[model samples]
Target: MPLTPIDPRLDPGVSAALAAVAEREVDQVFFVACGGSLSIMHPAKFMLDQHSAALPSDVLNAAEFVARAPKRLTKQSLVVLCSMTGTTKETVAATKFAQSAGALTLVLTTDPASPLAEAGDHAIGFEAPYTTGVPIDAKNSNYARIYQLVLGLAKIFDGSDKLGALMDSLEALQPAIDRAHTHFAPLFADYAPRLAKKDVIYTMASGADYGAAYSFAICVLMEMQWINSHAIHANEFFHGPFEVLDENASFVLFKGLDSTRPLTERAETFLHRFGATENILVLDAAELDLSGIDAGLAGNLVPLIFFDTLWRFAYKIADLRDQEMLEARRYMKKLHDY
Candidate 1:
């Protein structure tokens, strides 16, 4: 069965909010949040960097952003703060900080009445039911909405209809991603038992997909399952971290269709040839049949689609290990005073 398109149901008020930002000539955009929400915005920052140079963008940790109050944030800046519950203390505080700094603020969250949402000048209530642990559906939906929203605003400002056309072509994205997950589900299920024995693992990727690598390593692998993992960029793999790689190393590599595909290829080649006892699992985006998607826009969408595959893989690993994803947290909410 095909999954429904999530973007079409976004509140109509969001369009007016985004359009208002464009009309005001927003010069800077800030993707601000904490934890997984912050990780979700990383690709959007990458997208903005690649497509819209006129709009300077940054992804900031909500607490750090509020504490360090950037001098450049002003009325012409747009801050996007997302929280699933919309009650995260730092994120809500960051929303207030951005507002105090006179920046145009938009909040994306499940609750419209939550502090973060109310603190912003405008908010888009996702209305998606939250899932336990990683919240795959919610995160993916937010990613789609954020990506489209950012591009839509850019299109309005640049007076180019390219993003609009690309979005139209992506109407079937939910199903395309679903298909990728179905294909990879069995592989992840089989790999989980072998992976559960390892005390630590290395996850690596490059380019736009680096966010996926980081999210899985930190959010799912480390936080959810209490496994020790490191996410390294392929381009930087040869740096200081290369010394840690040996025959006994365990690794998960993500390869995508972006320009940095060669970087991942090189890293994969080196690890395979040199690391004899290494347990290597490579997930190449090209393995997924993307014929249903537009060729021109495929490169941009592949990384996002690949993230869905990675999430399922991580979820399987956690389940196989008999770890309760939600109960693994010790310090996140346990020690709230920090």
Candidate 2:
């Protein structure tokens, strides 16, 4: 069944908030968050990097941003922070720090009343399946909201006319995700036992999709399933990591239609010829039916769609290994001190 189509319009409050930021002198944009939240910021920064001609952007880990404060982060900067629960201590602290620096802070979280939200100058709440434990309208997800924010900034600062196209693309994201689930179901089932047996798994991607690889490796495999995993950029794979290639090595490679597709494709060709690893799994964005999305915007949206698809694979591996994917964390929030 097709998912309900999302309204191809920005939320009124989100639009108003961006308008308020446009009134300010924002010379730079910083996206600050922790863990999965941080991962989501990467594609936004990448999008802005590709489109915005004037405004510089950076994605920073929340704790690192607070510790190593950038000199450019001043009153003329806009800082965006995101957290699913809004209580992530590092992100909340970063938001307060940005506010103290007199930077305009925009916060995105599922919880409107979260400390991170309150710390920011402007807050936009979004619905997430992780928070709600049910499928949500794609337009209300963090990916969509953050992409909207980036597109809004581009439209205002770079004089871009891609927002309407972006809206159309976002509307198609959920159905793409749904199709991915159905398409990958049998493959994930077949791959689960092999993945579960692996002591370490390496994820690889380049360009805009790298964040999805990183989040799946760290957040899903390492944190949730307690597996050893690392995300290696395809652009860097040939330089050093490729030496580890052998029949025993396990990898999940993400391929997207972005400009850096060749980087991953090069690595993919090498992996097949030299790695000799039957455990290699490639999740290509091209495999999904994206006919509803704009051609120019579909590549950028790959991370969001890939994240959703990879999430199901994580669950499959977890079930195969008899590991509790979510509640079995040993040292995360349960620890009093890291």
Candidate 3:
């Protein structure tokens, strides 16, 4: 079965809470999460960095945030935390830490009954689909919900009426994503057999698309498929990661319609020079016709477009390799009491 979008409407209370956050004049936003949830906040952080510089932000590892306890985390700080399970010990602890620091804490999770959700000053619990048989759907729905919440925050802070149109643009994103899947699945299927043979891969992206590349590499490939992979930033590619490009290297580059697209293109050029052109798979957001979305908004949506395209390839690769995306865990939640 094909994937469906999560509800685009923000819960009224959630919207009201965020509106109050905006009204309170939040100066710094700290996104605290671990693993994939942490990766999902990158785009939101990027948006703040690129567009709303006045509202500075940081993406903090939940445990690290609790350890360091940044001095700037105060009543004026808005801490956004999320846990898919709502029970990650570090995240739950971080939520308490943030609250204790007088920071406004917002949490997104699937289980309202869990500790993290219950600890938050404002919690929005999403309905996670039962994807026991459709692992991809689970991820897709989770990603979509994150998109709504993150971009909704962006909309509030950006202080532009443009976000009104952006909301509609986002609502239409699922159909565009479905179209991307339909167009790319055959090509991805053909490539998956060969890709599945590789022991390691390098995923690269610039600007907002890096969120998708990072998530796909760590969350899906490393954690799910047990594949060895590295997520590299395009601008940082030449710094040291370029040394790994042998003939057998697999490179996935996500290009987006942003100022940093040229940075990724340069990396792609380097990849072509160092390896076979076919060795580099480029997922460019510009190729996706996000027609009703504003150019700037579309640029921000690069992560979503990239994730939608790349994860489908990953799902295909997992299928060809007979790997269970949900079952093969090395140390994530498998430890007895870690």
Candidate 4:
């Protein structure tokens, strides 16, 4: 596969849409997607939660959302639908439902002509920089593309200087990711395949990293590695699910600048209570300087770097093995029942 393609298509498109819609305060934000799109929406949920505390992050599995959560819509209700192809059944339908409710709907997608994109008030499409020709695990360009839109929004809404410093931070951290992958590659050569074949790998993180932890383990690792993984919020880990911990299972966690060390520490103590399963803590070694950026913004970027880097590194490793290679309809068809 070629060097992982970076998506630049949605940069100006999404940035401009957000700039134009800057008038909307977005009283309520609903993130709607199914499968991988929902997974990737994790970062946006985290950022929106932190930046727009006034706007609650409600991630709905599009079908369940329209069925159960339907409410009177105001211009305040902002619905962001993510579907790389712009044809996923759930996303397309939900965008229509959200619109019917009178909520403002936006779409982030790869296909501008897709039915899903057409349903949105604004459609942000990430132009893939390149293509991976391999039949399996071949196309993952959109994941990064949609991610840039989120980071770009960070620049506009959260005041990250319009991706200037975020890009710099990513550039600086890219090397750190390269180094970490080099170190873990060989060690994980055997372990990755082993864990990938297991029944499940549980990823746990509290606060903002929760969505990322879920996305990395369940979405990226499981989807790419062809394994089973699920993410959990840290505080909720003790609600009795820990009883299932065992040697056959694997447990994964993320360590980054804004990560909640104590909750994870508590999880560790609880995991010891069960006495099984291997534990891996992926750390963000990226040393970002916050003196230049706002203190509140610093925490968000640190973990976001880990989120951006870990999935890419995992995909690269999977690429060498030609695994976790689900693409749009062909790939997700097997994974999703709908």
Candidate 5:
């Protein structure tokens, strides 16, 4: 079935937030969040790194951002933070810390009434499956909002013209994701039994797609399913991690169309040659139908597309192991004191 098309328009709040940032002499960008929120910021930082020559950016964990207290974080800095519930203690503290430094802060969350939203200089609300059980199209996701904000900043600071093409791609993202889900469904089911037997699953990827692999390993596999997992950078896989790759080991490699794709392809080549063929599952973005997106920009959006598809695979493995994805948490939110 064809998924519902997303509206191509940016949220009005995004425009206003960009306008506010444009008024400042912003010198640097810091993406601050925790867990999956931090993962989504990786591609935004990568986008700015590729397109903006003068603006420097970094993705920082919320608690670390507050603790490290970089000297560069000042009135001239733009701090962007995301928390799905807008109530993450570390994130809220980071938002207040950024504001205390007189930095321009933009917070993305699902509610206007959230404490994180109330604390930021600007806030943009997004629809997400985490907050609402109903699945929203990718266009309205926190990743889309962050990407749009980064594209806007790139345009304002570096005079880049990629936002229009990106908006167009966002409109087509849902159908592409639908097609990918359809294609990967049976493959995931077939792989689930073998995957369930593994004690630890390693996820590998490079460039912008690395964040997706990281999130799947930590958030989905470890947090949700209570599986032992680690995410490895494909570029660094050759350094020392390859020694651990035997036929009994399992891995999920993500290959995207970005400049760092060759790095992952090298890892894939070695994985096959080492006789780990049956235990390795490769998810290549090149296999997805991205005709709706501009060729130059499609690679930049691959992480968003991969997230939608890999989420289904998470459920498949969880089902095979009789684990409850949502209700199985032991210490995530149950503890009062850390």
Candidate 6:
């Protein structure tokens, strides 16, 4: 099979999967994953809920899930577990637990032999064009692919052809991705101080970018920024934490050309509650010609461009530092030890 780049495959598969969901009789979905996959998996989950309204979705960290979310594996639940490597220990355990409770399991993975894959009743395989965790600053091919598949799945759910234009648009995006790298150099340099200086670094995203925001914040905390950067959902921002958004915090809001508009706008409104505007940065992204996208496909992808941009930003930040920065985490370490 020809290797599919993460960015391209994500939109289509997600649409297709969601389409499949709509055609079926599933009542709920449980996504168990870690790292990039975990982060990127969310928008699809949200879109799935938003589009079909047929099922409720949950994206959980593999480790905490197996131990705490026993409700996920009940007989009535339909479990969709994702782990890029297909070998995350917690994911594997969760799948087995879900199966034991009589739930049907669908596994999405890069490797078929992975424990998660083997445990699932049905498994789908995808390959990414780029590396996952090779170098400090490399792109996450799987993360990109998840976005593509999620969008594709959504389109499939709606049985619409709208996503085709966006799928076609992928070939043209390379130049933009390349151009983005060039412009990012200075921004990475500017944020380098936070990596080396801040007392507490927190990353926030409101609305649609919340997943990417949460995922990247965790990455920075675990990989480079080296602090407990909480990923605050914009809706929840006003509830309590908005009070803390001050000069001490660094916030980044993600933008995509969709419902994210209202989400980002609302997020901006809350930023002022804490006087976080001056210190805030909106991740820059150009709107693509997704006019051809199917309603199903749009939800899957709307969040992807932002996810890719944020990951790239995190990747560059890691690159600016020495090898010691990324040397800390190597794939799904003890998680898949089984």
Residue-wise C-alpha lDDT for candidate 4, range 168-193, written one tens digit per residue? 44444434434555654554554565
Total colliding residue pairs, candidate 3:
0
Q: Return the TM-score for candidate 1, rounded to 2 decimals.
A: 0.88
> Model 3: per-residue lDDT, tens digit, 186-287?
667666777788889889987777877888899888988988997899989999989988777888888888778899989988998987665677776766
Candidate 3, 326: how far from true, in Å?
0.8
Output the lDDT of residue 67, model 6: 77
**lDDT for each residue of candidate 6 in 1-338, tens digit (9 for 90 to 100):** 11233234443444344444444455566777777667766766765655544356778787777778565467767677777778667788878888887776767787878887789876766664333443322123444444444444445444333344545544444444455556655666566545534445566654456676777677655555465577777667778877777766767766545565666668776665665444566654444444434443443444555555555556655565443444556552524544
What is the Cα-based lDDT of residue 115 in candidate 2? 91
Which portions of model 5 show Cα errors greater than 4 Å?
Answer: 1-8
The lDDT of each candidate is 0.75, 0.86, 0.75, 0.60, 0.87, 0.59
lDDT score for candidate 3 against the true structure: 0.75
lDDT of prediction 1: 0.75
State TM-scores per candidate: 0.88, 0.95, 0.88, 0.72, 0.96, 0.73
Q: Is candidate 4 or candidate 6 better by TM-score?
A: 6
Best candidate according to lDDT: 5
Worst 10 residues of 6 by lDDT: 130-139
How many clashes (backbone N, Cα, C below 3 Å) per candidate?
0, 0, 0, 3, 0, 42
